[model samples]
Target: MDKRRTLTESALLLLVSLFVMISQGFAAQQVIYLLTAVFLMGIGFLLPKSVNWILILSTMPLCYWWPDIAYYLPPLLRILSMPTKRFEAATFFVYSATLLLLPLSAYQGIIVMLLAISLYLRQNDRAMTTLGQDFLASTDDHWEKQQQLALQNKQLLDSHETQLALQIAEERNRIARDIHDNVGHLLSRALLQIGALETINQEPVLEEPLAQLKQTVDTGMDHIRLSVHDLHADSLSFAEAFQNLLMIEHLCPVEIQGSLFTDLTDKQHNCLSMVIKEALTNTLKHSQATLLTFHFKTLPAFYRLQIRNNGIITNEQYPPKTGIGLQTIQQRIRLINGQVHIAQTDTHFQLTITIPKEPTK
Candidate 1:
């Protein structure tokens, strides 16, 4: 029950009573009826919380000296007397009073019936409001549960991915070991046999073919050794690998800035290692660079690698040839959907690579 609304209704009832007093044929009791109605309105507005007490006293006047607008009395009285918290036995007593005293006329009867209907509808409205609040509370609980499930699912997926990566690394290490222990030993024996046969006297024609065969076999063995090293490359930490590349003998001084975080996958680590190795090789072999600089940085959405050298003294008099090392760097970057840019000026050469931290599938 709204206090303001109840007060407004009480005030309106007083106004109706004033209109009724003016229409009534009797003059002696009109002033008394008007005064009673005004007094009740004032009580309703000023002490809305105590309106029920006023209601008990109010009914005496309505039954004793029925006002011209007595039709308004029963509804107003019923509203005030009814329990605000919940329905109670007191409601039936108010209902009985309303039925017994309500003005018996088609017009007044119809008005009384409408007032009852209005009260009934307002009760229904309050019930619906309570239900709506409960529904919203239930919806909030459901949304929280969904969020918890999503977080749990993500954790499970990350754990699975970590296990898969460990298994792959183990498998790669096993393969590298097998290749080194078995294939490497076999190649060494073949080389020893070839050397022993070389010392034996042979025709000049046979000697030439045997030397060519030995060269081919040595080249194949070198390729196999390189493959085995690559297979085990994933075991090396990024920092260790980068430092090893820097420690290699070079004509120029190498400077490093920033560092990479350890949240990268094995494939990313391997690719980055190869890029640094190839870039440094180019600097040592081709650039007469006196100073080499390597810069690494991680951003919110991307990781950047930059390598620059001030060794290329030659200005771009003509196009610089793109070598296999540079080509390999580009291919590795492409595999991760990264971008690589190269810049060469009269005194310096720079390679910049940027890879998104989370690559889109």
Candidate 2:
């Protein structure tokens, strides 16, 4: 039961018991019964539910000894204040027995019964209110869980779609490579043979035919080259490719931040991928780093990549005297008209790269 409701019920019971004692005319015995009622009510409120049964049973002996029907009010009030239904049926039987066995006037018996009935109804109302609140709380929890599940399912579906797209791109690239290697080489060989025939031919009539055959082979080679280029370009999805790279096993934990929304040419994608790969490799091989991070950002005119590690680079490794890795990184950036900056301090090493949005001719 709620504390406020319990206090209210106890107060009402106390007031009613006092009124009944005064109406029946004050006596030493009446005063004692009132005092005892207050004491038992206090105990019922302060103690746990386990002690309630003992208090109720104690009331049985008091009722027989005192035989005043009004004395039963305190224990009945205690029963009404109880939150559990465990002792309800037994308590009702005990109260009914006491009411029937007591040799009291009909008026006293009726008043006691009416008060008990009213208190019982109030207890039922409080119980219903508590049950409704519990149901609402449970419903709220169920709804929140469903929302979380839906979000997780959406994320799962998006991941599957991205993987499927990557697989298709890979297959297309494979087909393009096969065509370029086999058919393109054969066409080139035929064109070369036709050129040699034209050079060695003494018959003037065969020269035009040889030139036309060489032209056809050259056209087929051009078509193969164009197709291969398209396949490679289509295969380079910067976001997906970068995510795949991040998934690779590394010595240190890597934190990735930022978003990829800018479109990149195939060359730009490959350049950035290689640069990132080399940087990661250097960090693993040279630095005693425990954590690595990659931050990517797209600016109005350029795409920026920042690779950082909480590791120190000694004087021997600072300028990179003999290593080809840093040199290759610099060379690749220059090819795409991008800038590279390397910074090292006592606590951290950072590599920043920025490539122009528009490719330079």
Candidate 3:
């Protein structure tokens, strides 16, 4: 699965085949040991990389069986075919030197070769296993660090969102303060002027325009009052936010219908709440008919929210600019690495949102 490992495996398999061909009775007596090493490394036409060093070490026994050492002891040099490349001279020297302590014969040379190769192979095997264990431990540590990073990143984003929400709330309160200080008093004065004009200025043309102006001022007053009435609800928990969604049918014809397929988390509530508000607003403003629906479902990697309006869309410019409630909703979802998609057809308008429940988080 890893690129480096794959390449190494490929290379090792080729090397094993070469080793088997070259080792075929080149050393007539050491053939059994060479075959055993090759079989272990390339078992399923898929050699595990962990056995590379073992394969190389298995060839060491064949060195002493080469033809170069026949003159030193003519009687014991019959094993001239153990196929290998490294330390042929060294193996002969060590084996020959050891053989000098006793009678030099073919049978005795075989025993000497076996003893030295077995020791090196066993030591190499143990060392390889220990290195593999160290590699596994390091991998586990890296995985834990990545998880910690993801959690810290999630917390930082939530903190950022809380700060932004506070700022927006402060801006709303400031707007309300401005209305109370300047616009509210100005409208009061305009209402008094309109009252005075009703008594004194009786021209019919002037009267209708003045009445229209008063009506216009009254409309502005109503808008200011609505802006002052903040509609935001800080979700205390997942249950409260979900309950608020269910309660939307009272304010509009919202068919709040769907099973929470996945368990919802606290971070998702911010996005979900904003989505509910947008759906309700869209229903009231663009979708002229009844029966709007909110559906939520769980996915392995994301929590999905689908809002469908059964009402036909009439407003030509249905999708508003990233300015009002929808912008706030979009921003909230993206903070948690979520996505939003809007769709509209002849009879249905849907807003689908997917918030990540897993990684790349």
Candidate 4:
């Protein structure tokens, strides 16, 4: 039931109780009885009991011309359990007035109280039923909201899993193509040099180009080894990457400041490491300024990387014709679904990168 409806219904019952109690009692004693009943009604509403409502409802007989067993007044015992409700309260009021008229003895008011309580119980039970239905409806709505959240979470997980699989495939293809082309061709060239060296044992001068060939072979081998390790690992922890980045502080005149990384997930560590490397390379290649500062902060789901260089972006060297460094950083960030921002002005150049918690494969 609407809250308004419940209120209105209780009001009507109160009005009925007042009128009946006033008219049926002794004319002279009516006011006293009515007042007493009103006070008792307050108690019933304030503290209704199962037995009390029942008594109040049944005791309406006391408002009649001859109140019966307005006699056995003291038997009902209900003060202990009454829970307050309005209708039952009014019923007790009228019952009290009617009981005053009976006054079988000084103690007759007790019987009327008992009967008043009984009737109040019946009315209270109806109100409680309506209240129970409202409670159940609210519970149902709460359960439905929880179910919707669970479904949305499931969909998001499924999408992430699909993207991860696609990215792994792409990485695999890239590694395959690089190894087959660069490493394969370099090794093949090295083999030809070995054949030439074996057949032509002429002069020591012929061996110079073969030594260069051997150096190329070693470099190719090193590149292949690093590539294979990276392909398998897919991640670098915070300590390793941050330590590698810090190596610059000792070697260059640049003064690096601010807190080092405390902790980061494997993927976050990798993304930040790449961004730092790219930013430092750009600073050296583009700007001739000396000082560099890196500030990193850990957020709930991502990391914020800021690199500031005190070098001014000169008009001639700002690379407006071609920003290859900027393009490379942008591509790397995009691969992981992260964002990179480059701001170069007369006074300073800032590179800020935000990498999300879950990167694209």
Specify the poorest-scoring 10-residue window by lDDT in model 1: 313-322
Candidate 2, pairs of clashing residues = none
Backbone clash numbers for all candidates listed = 1, 0, 3, 28
Against the hidden reference, what TM-scores do the models get? 0.46, 0.49, 0.38, 0.38
Q: lDDT (0-100) at residue 342 of candidate 1?
A: 89
Superposition error at 355 for model 2 (Å): 39
Ranking by TM-score: 2, 1, 3, 4
Which candidate, 1 or 2, has the higher lDDT?
Answer: 2
Model 2, 57-146: lDDT tens digits are 787778888877344464455434454554565576576667677766664565456556645755575687689899989999999999
- TM-score result, candidate 3: 0.38
Of the two candidates 2 and 3, the one with more favorable TM-score, higher being better, is 2
Cα lDDT tens digits, model 4, 1-361, are: 2334333443444444444444355475655554554454445445535656565555456435434333322212222233555544555566466666664554444455454644554456556766888789989999999977875665556445535744664566467557757776777677676767757767777677777766777677677767755663333456666667667643335555556565544444455566677677666666767778777776888767788888865557557324655655665566567898777777778888777765333
Give candidate 3 misplaced runs (Cα > 4 Å).
1-110, 200-209, 230-361
Q: Tell me the RMSD of model 1 versus the true structure.
A: 16.9
Over the stretch 1-361, how does candidate 1's per-residue lDDT look in tens digits?
4555555655554455455445535677767766665565455445544446556556556644573535455335434534353542344345445545655444454445544543554465456656888888999999999988985676556445544654576578679878989998998888888888887847776787778878988998999888888887555678877777788774489888888646665567766776788788777877688899888898888889899999773434323445545666776677667889989888888999998786421
Per-residue accuracy of model 3 over 60-83 as CA lDDT, tens digit each: 343345322222221121112122
* Best-to-worst lDDT order: 2, 1, 4, 3
